[model samples]
Target: MKKTILLLIIISTIISCKTVKPSAENNVLVLKGTVEKMGMSTFQYGTHLLKTESKTYALKTAIVKLDDYVGKEVSITGSKVEGYPVENGPDLIDVKKIVIK
Candidate 1:
């Protein structure tokens, strides 16, 4: 009876455990672009992104809370995080600083 309970507990623990998601917070990148709000719906708030001549990057961290510079051109320093594309999709960045151009 004790062995069965222990096995059940172990199984339950394993089932309850969640897989850790991988992140790209460690890869740093420097970029320059204009800030733009993004989303599909008109009523919902959209995400902020940096638009460059050749690419767009989803900006986070530094600019997530600050919105004074929207639609303005600026240079930013940040890290390349997951979900950003290296060749096609908009790059993802955790912005550290922004310099207006």
Candidate 2:
């Protein structure tokens, strides 16, 4: 009887556990362009810039070194940070993954 109850409790606990996902992953957006080191900026943010045919994005990442991908055309997956495009700058993205094209 005790063994049966313990087994049931363990099963319930396992089933009730929820997987945690990164907050940034929830707003996944993709951008493809050539990356370049951002020059001097008075209002613009981010360490790098991605220029596409239609738009541009300012990008920063804590997961990897974006400098390695500078001057290279790459596809990036990221989330837009809130309160961005400030001062007529490009949208800021928290880069999650980047792949050279």
Candidate 3:
């Protein structure tokens, strides 16, 4: 009886550990760094910029609705889109939060 109960508990725990998909309500990965460069033209959506590590990324529309957030320290989060940094790009990241830090 004890072994059976233990087995059931383990199985339940494992099943409950599945990863949840990022959603608009809770789909923001916090990022901290100085904004290396911001997109100047309207072609780029939602303030596209890079981090200190030179990684290119963009904030989702939820955070800020501007194409200028350059040269500033910021903390933001958004759904990670596959292809970004392109003009009029299809890459879309669902932002959850953004904070200047």
Error of 2 at 25 (Å): 3.3
User: Native-vs-model 1 lDDT?
Assistant: 0.69
Q: Give the TM-score of candidate 2.
A: 0.73
Expressed as tens digits, the lDDT of each residue in 7-57 for candidate 3 is 999988877764444344454466666654344655556455546454555
Please give each candidate's TM-score: 0.57, 0.73, 0.45
Model 2 stretches with alpha carbons more than 4 Å out: 1-23
Task: List residue ranges in candidate 3 displaced over 4 A.
Answer: 1-27, 36-46, 66-68, 82-92
- lDDT of all predictions, in order shown? 0.69, 0.88, 0.59
Residue 8, model 3: lDDT of 100
Which 10-residue span in candidate 3 carries the lowest summed lDDT?
19-28
Which of the numbered candidates is closest to the native, going by highest TM-score? 2
**Candidate 2 C-alpha lDDT tens digits along 1-101:** 99999999998786666334345556899889999999987666899999998998899889969999998999999999999989889899999899999
Considering TM-score, where higher is better, how would the candidates rank from best to worst? 2, 1, 3
Per-prediction backbone clash count: 0, 0, 0
Model 3 score (lDDT): 0.59
